[model samples]
Target: MKTLLSLSIGALLAGSSLLSTSALAATHAPYTHTQFSITESVQPADILVVLVPENAGELRLAGWDRASRNHINRAIEVAGFDGKAGAQLEIVAPVGLSYGRLLLLGTGNPADLTRAKAETMGASLSTWVNGTKAESIHVNSQLIANAADNHRISAALAHGVELRNYRFDRYKSQPEARPSQRYSWQVALATDARSKFEQKQALAQGVFTARELTNLPGSDGYPEAFANYAKTVLEPLGVEVTILGPEEVKALGMGALYGVSQGSHMKAHLLVARWRGHDDAQPIALVGKGNSFDTGGYNLKTQAASILRMHTDKAGGAAVVGAVKALAGQKAPVHVVGVVPLSINMISGDAYLPGDVVTAGDGTTIEVGNTDAEGRLILADGIWYAREHLNARVIADIATLTGAKVGALGSAYSAIFTQDAAIEQSLRQAGELVQERVWPMPLDGYDGIVRSRIADKINTGSPGAQAGAIFLQHFAADTPWVHIDMAGEAFVSSASGIHPEGSTGHGVRLLTEWAKLYQAKQD
Candidate 1:
């Protein structure tokens, strides 16, 4: 019986592993490769030929085959090697041949190969190779450099590919199972640039760590669990982590947050993570609404099917965690604090209802107009807590807050509402740099929509649907704050760039880049 029980437990563990394969993959050891020199005397069977394209001549030669004494038209034609931006072509040959297959990747305008672009290209290559079944991939260096820095170009390209091939799929029962039927390819880089490529790989790992947290599931990513995860990921890097539970939150009169938690069975929490890279500088605080599962409470959601995915409502909080994770991983010299207000919004007899007046942490009474407008309530408490307690100089809060943002900005860019033009510009600049676009939204006429007759303010507009973003702006309360309404971009129905269909991990990259920029300014 004991043996049987052990076997059962093992099976359960295996099953759990399968369920969290992606999560496990997030921290997997990165693939490493030694660089090799490019040779003109090459056969057609190399898996990934890295060639230096000094001019159009080198580009033409990359298509040539020494064995056949002609351009490899068959491989080019059959493999679909179009030299367009972000496109790749793969050719498979017999196992005994020089490299077994050839991969032709597009690098647009060889002259414009900056390190960033090269890294992106390498990541794209890695992403492509990861999908294939090749056991070995070779990169020809002759097709990728300017005479000024041949070694740097080679290393950058390899670094990009290595970073791109990264996947966080460790929790699966079959660890080797591929989404597609492609085999894992071994990459060979130009020998001289291997060290530089390794450094870039480390940076990519840090970036990937941040991205994974943003993409995590809410079931396993509860407030306390997230706080613990942060401690695990950052404590080793010297960041300080503090978790404020229900008792402490209530003691502090964080009514806005507590009111929302009243409906949840799970206790609400506020996680504060501090990283003091500078001795005497005021820290930038990132506050996020970590609603684990938002059901709209007594103002119950009519869209049952859609609301089922409300677990992703914590995307904003995840972004904050993700940014801090990246910053810590990179050992970035920046003073920052991440404040996450975590809870779930459910319908219960004890839940705060419409027309109810609740005093916030700041002692401002808010009349609850709609239970669905719970994000702002929690955020109100969090933002105030950050300013009054943490003594933050700049505050930014991100939330999958309102459907009105979707109606306004769609799913591409988040609607950014900020009182400070400088903060708005910085966020916009960061968003643009990372491709996580944000559009500045006006707050001028939003106050009228949330003004309350029965109390200091209403949770939402009386009209019930329109101008929700504008209504949410009132909760910021004159702080130098930026509210990112990520309702549209938090989750999506399709895939893009580095994101899959479900949670886009939308704000992670945006906030990380913004934090970096903010840190640079401080320095």
Candidate 2:
């Protein structure tokens, strides 16, 4: 085993800022600044959104006054919109109505209106009202029975709107204005909803940060730049940011991570961020693969999609940073550490070939099966570092590891591999809660597949996703761990609901939810 050389954040930041402060300011600022508030009475707005449940017998709009409800009921009857979840109806308010427009948002079966569904409803509503050019809007939370339910549902709704309003136009020299940018929100409820929504807002901002990082071009979003950005954003939020350069990584014997960066001039970076919410508790480690751009190394990606969209290869690491940001911003009472192995996989004379054998930080040798299978190799070192050096009791490593995962689960869900049933269940529940749903993939019966004749294991094997998981499992050793393959979930080809056409920032909310749950258990 190699000696772990601890370094201060100041030392790391001095040499690693590839972008200037002005450049960072232009590129890294928050994209949306929509204001939100909760009030006792419905405020005047261009539009009024009433949450409506399906009629068991009569049309129901519980919160609105009798005159407004009667007008909306007539509009609903004319539109023939059944009060199914996600069903929406908008009508021009008549002469007597106070608002310019009225929107009836369905809750489906009242019992079926979960937090997840409520978020989706908010996304759908935001998307629908985009072109309507509404400057201010009020969402009636009156139908929700009690203050607690109203707070939770309103927070969820506003979170969805915040997420849906995300726009990545940094690169656009003359971007068109989005109406969501100008709107202010009022969610009508009895009790204060800002605190709950503030927590969710932190998460939304985290997701936005992740999306911006993922969407940045490889030319601008290199390893050093990522480290610099993390230090700038996370450190202020009380995260301890430590960055290790190539020589330092080599000294630490992170050969598997270092090997991938051999071809690139940018070198490699191991970014460790600690959010110490507790004094002495063992932290949950989030290890992510941070390949800023992937060119399949010496193997070379001949396909256009693989080469063109390779900038998003670092999304897993971006998500880890985002989750940390969210946890720190919300002041969650949980100790968590994010370990990201940053590199750019390019084809060059110095590139590590497919047949090369690299030693991991734990001294396990990994025979590179394919240069394109570089994510697992880097994560191997990251997971080991987290488990051994950071004293993380539970390790969850996420990456855009395989195309086979997309083939298996499509873009709808992330693929999770874990031996622990509890970890799997918790991750699934968290993912579901945040709309970043995960489907469990088998981790067993693949021990032989990753077995190599010379090394401890091969980087990849026959069943791509399973074999990759097995190889990473060796690094985690006996520690409880879960591997999330988010290849298909990270980038979207088209805009849908809350997601735009670029990076989805998928894992931020899921990881935050899981970490919160894990913290509760620890407490």
Candidate 3:
């Protein structure tokens, strides 16, 4: 377990409302790292892994001696292990090898081994290795026929291993201890994949940070704490962070956001974090809805299951900061701005009630049909601020905003709403590559869903998910924008794939990859 180290230091900037600092330090729980060495030779280890492709005729064992190959062949013949993807075979005390164990990991087809598939294979490998007590392992990466493809596949596998190792045990009374001894990980490849692997490591770091923040209980996960985290984690990496407390938020005329904050004794805040890897390039904005803990305001949630995990509502904000951390950590040449509006929608005497209308930062009026629909209210002002004040070239707001989205897409995909076909296509491609996939939802006919008789727009509408998208789209105006309703994708009910049974950290990779692609196109 790790905690924030406190210091009696404070500063004020940007007016009476902006509080910014770089001296704060918040340490996260220590993450595990396997001591990996890239090499051309397969060193002797307790466990030796041979890569077996489905096309056995095309398989090429780079460093295996004749004797070792004969023994492996005999084992393969005996076990009837044709190299199908996800198939595994193990032999203990092999005939010609002194190793304690020999394992064969299957690659479906060398030609079909994409980065996504490689990551899946790596995840499976992590699980298999964790079940064993081996102290070291050697992996052979010579199964693929193409050298460039081999390097990329190997790097993606290493990334998968790192991602699967993430565990959130901060509050566990006796957290399960991982294997104490430092495990030695050696990989034999024709070309060095260390640089590629390190880039993936940077992404994993961002994902880990996003997961940790989302897993924290509402008691510890608050607006101030998140701001402190950004200052501590991102500022050192050269990102500029600014924290706007309740006063600042109200002073900026973000009435819709301020209305939602009145419900909680704990005030709301707006956090602005910017990472500028290029001086003159226009920055893209990543706006995340930071509802630290939502009690549905006056329209309280009746079921325990619905309210038990509301702390994860802040997952979107965590991912935005995480993506920025990743881009800045690698010093990627892109300018990105992150706008997160942090608030807790708890019931109180002063809480904004249903049917109330409030003006947003951009002077648009919003009627609160259902106080439970608070995410879009805060995001409304967040998007407006990003576009009007920050001068962002494109705006993408991600949130676990609607339950209707879950019914529409389920746990497999997130729902994205955008008018621009290019933005939609780019986001989908990025999501597919990173495995945080997005499917487009209709935004045209849904405009009527948010049309309010009493205000500029209604926060809640008939088709819940599309209504939320259209509500935020009003704030985005004519800018290239996308509204990602990740209600189904942010947190998982069960562990699967590379994600554990908790916050998936879904948007961090998607946003980071999209930003990379967007910047490349700009050049």
Q: Give Cα-based local distance difference scores for all models.
A: 0.63, 0.80, 0.78
> Against the hidden reference, what TM-scores do the models get?
0.79, 0.91, 0.91
- How close to the true structure is residue 51 of candidate 1, measured as C-alpha lDDT? 43
Report the lDDT of model 3 for residue 514.
92
Candidate 1, poorest ten consecutive residues by summed lDDT:
4-13
Candidate 1 stretches greater than 4 Å from native? 1-46, 49-55, 59-65, 68-82, 94-97, 110-127, 146-219, 462-478
lDDT for model 2: 0.80
TM-score of 1: 0.79
Show where candidate 3 strays beyond 4 Å.
1-25, 57-67, 179-191
What does candidate 2's lDDT look like per residue over 1-523, in tens digits?
1121111111111112225423443233345645565566646788888766667334455345777657666776788888777788878864356778878777766656788888877787778778687887877756655566667777777778778877777666687775443333334443356668768877877887788788878878888888887887788789999999999999999999999999988899999999998775689999988999999997789999679999899999999999999899889888999999999998788999988999999988888878989999899999999999998999999999998888899888999999898898889889888778899999766559988888888877878888888888888999999999998788888887778779999899999999999777667
Candidate 1 achieves a global lDDT of 0.63
True-vs-predicted CA distance for residue 147, candidate 3, Å: 2.5
Which candidate model has the greater lDDT, 2 or 3? 2
Higher-TM-score candidate of 1 and 3: 3
Q: Looking at candidate 1, what is the lDDT of residue 228?
A: 59
For residue 415, model 2's alpha carbon misses the true position, in angstroms, by 1.8
Question: Of the pair 1 and 2, which is ahead by lDDT?
Answer: 2
lDDT tens digits by residue: candidate 1, 1-523:
1010000000001111113422321132322232223322342323654443422232344334554313344455565555554456655652223666666666556656566566666656656666656545555545444533555655566545543443445434566543321122112333334445443433444444444444455556555565655565666657799999888989999988888878766667898988786664568889987887777888888897778777778888877876776566556677888999987787778888887898888788899888888888888888888888988888888988877777777878888877787788889888876567899877665447777898877777733333455544455556577888888676556544444445655676678778778767656
